[model samples]
Target: MVTDIIAQAFVDFIRRVCECENLWKAHAKDLELAKVGDEVTKAISEGVEGEYGPVTVKVRKKLLGRREVRVWLYGNEIDVDALLAEISKARSRAAWLLNDCSENALLETLYKYEDRYLIEVAQRNLDKVKNICAGELPRIEFGEAPAHVVEGVVKGVRIYLSGHGTSA
Candidate 1:
């Protein structure tokens, strides 16, 4: 059935979005790592001019406060607050996308696709994937980054940062 085809694509896309969302949520505080990664990488990534720009910087585990955290202050420039805000919005959007664009969403779209032509719906959803793949999503710097980037960083930080905070 056409719905099945569309459903498969939808599930794949939404699952990716879910993984991306979880990654952002895990690094909701570490903007530096969220923007880049734990290692050094440089590329000509710019959706527009006057943005983060091209530069090279290395990131690694550094002791901060009573624990180790990843922070970048040399080689490249980024707004920590801004990055955190983006992470917040990204997290919310990911959850929304997964829920809103789930199998049911695709099924519903399939009806419209059928009414109009299957290609139409497929293109729209595919556009989302393309944008995501190209890192053109709303508030993310890079979407192609592996899903484990943030997850790994968080686990690494939690190894040292978890108990340092006193909340009760």
Candidate 2:
């Protein structure tokens, strides 16, 4: 029964991790949109500041003549070409920030959330969850016999239990 409970814990941990990740992915697009907008705004503001000495700028996307967006610096039209370049630079910056997250760093963050979620769902002590599913278990043996398989992600590596032992 204890073994069953532990096995269930492992299953539940994996499910929650996947669920959390799916939820994150579903919202990722919205976050990206927000990031792009913020970056564009900052880039335009900085460009305008550099050229016009720190004046407030408002941006509008209209079917303007030969430009992607129109900028109004305190109720006056600014150079459309310059504004377009600023938009391009901002988009590239946002893309780089979104894509440059180190895999290890992202996995570390995921692990922390996975642990928290598992603990909440299992109603188990934090340490116990870490031992069972967080890959702290060197080798899992149940009631004097080892299980056929135990699989999980540990420190950004996938671990699988084999007949001989565990392997990455």
Candidate 3:
């Protein structure tokens, strides 16, 4: 709790410096925000690691054309990053189902595979998935799935929303 507060304060400090730079753009030296972020991470990391075992703090560069950059504090107890990746894949599948499958077909598919759903996630995430079914389908910005995109089955289809709509 104390560490969280301190971390937030450090984040606020960097944000203020950026705000000042924005106000005096040409006058100000461009702050190496990455270095500042690294220092903040180092400052707070030791206590956190002592409290929780084998913690890693990562400060990432914001992606090009992206608005938000995040700091991640990970504990080595379990492979949380791998777990997050799996859940992210599962959540993407759920969103794909919610968007691509028709209402009747989706309910029937869910009914048929209720056991699969239960095995996949807890109630809170299941509720998040149920809420996903309520929204309008997202217009996919990409014309084709990327080369790195994994192929997987959803509701007996070989891949989610195949172009020809045939099992492969």
Candidate 4:
């Protein structure tokens, strides 16, 4: 129960940093925000593993004036350098899309880019949640029950019967 509270606090910290207002505005078109929300839900469902968790993202590209520009988003563990690299790769692919295909052909590329970006943001938020949880848990005494155990046994009775004594 205490760990749950700590986890929730961590989520709240992520929410504060991610900002609902910005998140809403960022995905207002075509239920993009809704999709991002779903991804976040999926990430949380995966639970915290070590310092972070993993999530999936989709990215796409849009073409304008003979040039295909890519947009990307993602959700998962935030590694800023890795994200930048993914973005760079997406942009390069977008260039190829522009050179070899029509505007309509860029649809998949645009979606892929956007998804990548969403995943990246989600990861950053997850990290924040982890940090918050780490900070809050030390102050509480939840008893020692092996750090690996997320839930402790409560309100349970153990009975042992012996020749000389009976215990419960």
Give the per-residue Cα lDDT of candidate 4 at 36.
40
lDDT of 3 by residue, 34-146 (tens): 22333434434322222212233333335793332223333333343443343345445444443544334333333333333322221223333332223312222222422
Per-residue alpha-carbon lDDT of model 2 for 61-125, expressed as tens digits? 44753224445433467675664454456456545545543233233433443343333333323
Identify the candidate with maximal lDDT.
2
Could you tally the backbone clashes for each prediction? 0, 0, 0, 30
Give candidate 3 regions above 4 Å deviation: 1-78, 104-168
lDDT of each: 0.38, 0.40, 0.31, 0.33
Encode model 1's per-residue lDDT on 16-69: one tens digit a residue.
544555555554534433344312222212111122322232233346723222
Tens digit per residue, CA lDDT, model 4, 1-168: 643433333333333433433433443432332334434434333431222113243322336623222222434444434544544554454444344333233222323333333233334334332333223222222233333222211111011011113232
Q: Which residues of candidate 2, in runs, are more than 4 Å off?
A: 47-168
Candidate 3 collision pairs = none
lDDT of 4 at 2: 48
